[model samples]
Every structure is written in C-alpha cells, then in structure tokens.
Target: MFYGDKLTELRELNGLSRKDLADKLSVSEQAVWQYESDKVTPRIDVLNALRDLMEVDTSFLFEPNMVTRGVASEGHIAYRADDRKSRKKTRTELTYLRYVEAFVDYFEGFLTQEERSIDSLRSMTKQQADKIQYAGSQREQNLEIENLAEVSRNYLGIQSNRDLMYKIENSGVCVVERNLGQEIDAYSTISKSGRSYIVLGTHKKSAVCRNFDIAHELGHLLMHQHQNIELLTNEEYKEIELQANRFAGAFLLPGAEFACGFATLARKSNPDYYVDLKSQYLVSIAAMGHRAYDLGLLDYQEYRYFSGRMNTLHYRKLEPLDDKIVPIRPGKLRALMEFVLKSRLTSVDHIRSLFHVRPQFLINLFGIDQHFFDQFEHEKHSYYGGAKVIRMPGA
Candidate 1:
C-alpha cells in the first residue's frame, strides 16, 4: 500500500502544491490529490516522474521509514535569520536537519552503548527551571544566567578556550558545520528522541565568531528546548534572543575572570587595548568591550565612546587577528563514517541507498570532500618502486 502522508511531506518539502505536482506529472490536480490521499496509487510512469522530481528513490514513497522517522512538528528549530524572505531558506534547512537526524540514527546503531554520565541541555534545564521561575527582577535573571553558565562550564570540564568543540561533542551534543546560506549564522533543534543538534554556518571565517555562534546556540538548547519558535511573537522572540546572548557572553567570559583581565587594561576606551584580551579569551574585541560594560568596569558613557570609536575604525566588520585564528570545524560525524567504512561494517553506497539521497548531499551535509568517498579508487593507484621483480619457482 502507498503512504499518503509521505507523499504529502515530500511535496511540501519540495515547495510544491498539488497543482504543481500534477503539472509535473501531466495529470489532473484531483488525481494528484487522490494519490496523496491514498484513494489511488501512482502508475509506474508517475512514480518514476516523482522519483526524479523529489530526488528520492521510488521505494521511499511507499516505505516512509526509509526516509524520515518522525514529522517536522516533533522538532523545534530556532533559526538565526530575522528576515521574512528567509522562510524558504528556513524550510530548506529543516530538510537538511531531518536528513542529519536520519544519519545519526543509522550511524549510532553500529556503536556500543556506554554508561558514562553526560550533562545535556534538557537535564540542566530541569535542574535550573525553578530558580529561573522564582527570579523576579532582571538583575536576578542575569545572576541566574551567570550561575548557569558557571555550572555548565564546570559540568563540561571546559577549563580554557582550547578544544571547545571536543567538549561540546563529548557532552552528547551533535555539532555540524555547513553552508547555511549568507543570511543564517546558526541554528539549534531538538529531535523527538531528545537528541540535541547545533549547526554552525560555514560562511563565518573567524574562529571567534563561530565560537560565539556555538555558545549562543548552546544557550537556546539549554533554555528554549521544545519551544515552538515559529509561533512566537516578535517581542517574545527578541526576549529569547536577548537571554541567549547573555548566556553566551557569560559562558564565554566569566564575570570574575573577565573583569579582572579588563582591570589590567591601560586604556579602557581604546579598541587596540582589547587585542590582547581577544587573543586570551578567543572572543571578538567587540564582545570583550560589551562584557566590560556588562561587568560594570566601563560605565554607559565610556561604553558609548568605545562603541563610537570602534565604528569609526571599522573594527566591527573585521577585527584584528580574525584571519590568524583557525576556525574549529566539526569532525565527530566524519570520524564515525570513517570508522564504519574502515572496519568494513558498512559501505558508502549502502548508507546512501538507505537514505535515498545523492553522494553530494552526504558530502555537503557532513562537511566532507569527494575524496572521502573516493578513498577506494585512490587506493587502487600503484606507485613504481625501484625493486627487482623475481619470478616464483612454481611460475
């Protein structure tokens, strides 16, 4: 029997209405609706056309489990883009997220389960919810956020700025890097099984900016999990963003440590003085300036003067050492794929067939190159060695 819901999901994922699909299939709109409603199944030719149109195998329409396991409603995606025109781009990203979930599900099946305890966003939220609820004033809320950041840092054992990505991955959060278009900086979502995913934009060249993006998304995962972001009002969304920004700031630069460092600055209002702090904290100069103001080291007037000077120097667009620091790239997923292939537990072809997606889709989603999948062909190349060829006695 054909699955109607699966067909409908595919059509919507492709941004096609019934009429659009019908036109592509050279059939009546009602016929397309009937097929999606399970009143009638598509013919062989129509199935082929759908397979081509959707870029999926024909069996995917009949076997829903072959593609995705859950509905989009089961997940909560928080996009970083604020423009209304990015709705289509958001949908495309959601599709990519679904595929990511599928890949994680399939890849984890081959690994042995361990009993190690790891702190996750959900667990932390439950532990801290009451404190957040009872907080009356904005000052109390800020204090709570700072406390949460301190607890989170200690929980993850992040002693310094080095190897931050590894600590996040070890905490069971799936971090992925991809080209999320120019508009989107990053996003976070929680799966039905409560798996956390944070996707970083590949367009960001500065490691400091990417680190801030990760920390911001981490804030969303810890504070706003399971919230339907699409239904949130503009004001509500802005408040949520503000909370995340505060979380990121405190998490990256703790109040006591950062304030002590700022007190050593010779010129509090000079942007150049922050270059050393930026290198020490692996955070941007602008962020460090804001942190100083937030920590009360710089008064409002001083912060304004600093901000105006920064704008005049054009430091906000591209700061010092932005080109020097190497951006941290995600590799946990790639390592899993390599282990599976090297151990002969599975092949690339089998994985692609299971997802019913193209190789380029996997390449782009996992941040790997074509050479990763072509390792077998590369191994076939023979190198000429200066050695005497000896014939065996039997030959």
Candidate 2:
C-alpha cells in the first residue's frame, strides 16, 4: 500500500486526469486504479516518477494517516472512512469531492514542504478553515459576487473563475440542495476540513440558479474556510448560514462602492423599481431585496412592494416561452479544457481516449453541435466537429 492512498490526491492537485497521469508514468489507468485501491503497489520507479511529476517531497506520500484530533464532522468522517471508500470508490457522486480532497492534499503538501515554514500547518490550515466557516468579516457583509470573487482571488490565490471553482471543491466543502421546485438554494457543508467543498443544486439547473448557488457556495467557502470540525445542530447551521449570507452580500455588493452607482440613479429614479435594479446590477430580484434593505436604500414598505413585484414577474405574459431549453453555459472546467486543446498542451484525440467518451460530448459541452463547426474549422476551433460526447473533468 506504499503511496496507495496518496497517489490519487497528488494527481488531482496537478489537475491531471487518470489517463494523463498514466501516460506520464507509462501505465494503464486501470493499473493506476489498482495502485490507489491497494490491490497492488507502485514500483519504486513509479513512486519516483510521481514525486517528480507532482513536484513534492517523497515524505508526503508516507504521511501516517488522516488522524483528526479535533471535533468530528462529515468531512472528517468521510476522509477517515474505510480507506477503500476514501481512496478507491471512484464511481459515486462524491467523485468530484474526492478530486477536491486530492487537490487540497496536494496544495497542503506543496505549502508544507516549502522552506519548512510550517510551525503547524495543520493549525494554519485549520484557522483558515475556521474563517471560511464561521468568522464573518465586515467586508463580506456588504460585498457583491464580483467583489467576493475578487477577494477570493487575492486572498486564496484564485487565478481565474475556473481556479476558484477548483479550489472550492478541493477544499472539501459539502454542497447540498434544497429543491424549491421552481427554484433551488444551496447549502454549504456544516463541517469542512482539509478540502473545501459546497453543497449546491445539480448541474441540470438554470444559469441564474446556478450562478446564485455558486455564489452561495462561494460564501460558504470564504466564511467557513477554518472554523469547526465538530458536528453542529440545525441551529448552528442556520447561524453559520446567516454569516455566510452576509459574506455573500458584501462580496457581491460593496456598500460604499455600489452605493455610488445607486446614488447616481437615485437622483433620476426610485431605488424601489425592482426591475430596474435587477437589470442594472445583473443580480436577482431577491438579491436586490436584501441589498436594498441592508443598505437602507429602500425602507421596509418599499422593499415589501418590490417583493410582491417579484411574484408577478415570475408569470407575466411576455413573449411565448421558447421550445428549446436554454442550456446553462459550460463553466470554467470546459473553458480550461478548450484552453489546453487550443494551446496544444494536449490533443483532442488524446482527451477523447482519456475520457472514454465519444467526441460529441466535447461538441455539446462547448456548444459545437447547434452551429456549423466546419466553417470555423479552417480558421480555428478548440474541439472536434464530430458530435460525440467528450470527457467531463473528473470522468
């Protein structure tokens, strides 16, 4: 079992698919799978290759265990589950979560091995984790999504939205969905540890909902990054949720900054016009309600009026609904895959082989199907024209 559990974690941090990792190591992915499962061990040469490929000290692969000394939570339990479940069970919905944990393990290793500055990387990691989970900053209470995203970029070193999403997952934040039927809201894991993850609605949702859910999850990631590893009751969850909500607000709407935009409009119009607010800010009606009330931009009466208006907007007889479902935009992962393809870092054919999917997956994911791909072929394109399913990130 040498490096059995560690290999998958390293692979995820490097953002390598199993196939890509296999290619680098000259082994079949199934063989790699066997190694992670402890069914067989990697050769000494393979361990050396892994160390180099992942740019880590060999000592990382020999970490004693996931010994959690603090309070227990879902994340702690999940990681400390039967090693088979944690390292080898790769077919469940939580596969994405596993990838996230692996990334965290990798990043933690990278930081810990640097100059040996970690007096207690575990405590450092835990503190950051607590801030992400509980401590709500003044800045967070009034931010908008862009503001929040920017803070995340600077503090957490998010290079791009794709990177941000990857980190959120890698940090082991749990996302759960509360199906509102017409709408869905997201919940972050009550307890998170090494990996940050968020509980959000399914992918088969609308863009607006997805955006909100992402923002919501992002709130959980930032506010709860390092708080409690112990279990919490529903009341604790609510309290944390409120803090996250404030954090989300401030991240999305900077009170002073965005107020300037509203103040200018206040001269010419009323802030209570919910439609006007939504269009101008590109936020939802509900969001506008919270933002307006928090900032004293709208009184309780006016805000209530705006709330009523939201119900009417939901079913107004506008243009007939289109037959085609508006597909949610392909997110950051898809964007990176295209970048990798365009950059020639990897080939489309190779990606296809790695994903074990037909090419149409790529076409549909990148929206290559509805339009004529051949026209763009001669000029330049990131993916294949053949309408075959392609490899999803974790797949």
- For TM-score, the strongest prediction is 1
lDDT of 1 at 209: 90
RMSD of each: 8.1, 13.6
Q: Give the Cα lDDT of each candidate.
A: 0.75, 0.45
Residue-wise C-alpha lDDT for candidate 1, range 184-221, written one tens digit per residue:
78888877766778888787659999888888888888
TM-score of every prediction relative to native: 0.79, 0.46
Poorest 10 consecutive residues by lDDT, candidate 1: 379-388
Q: How close is candidate 2 to the true structure, as a TM-score?
A: 0.46
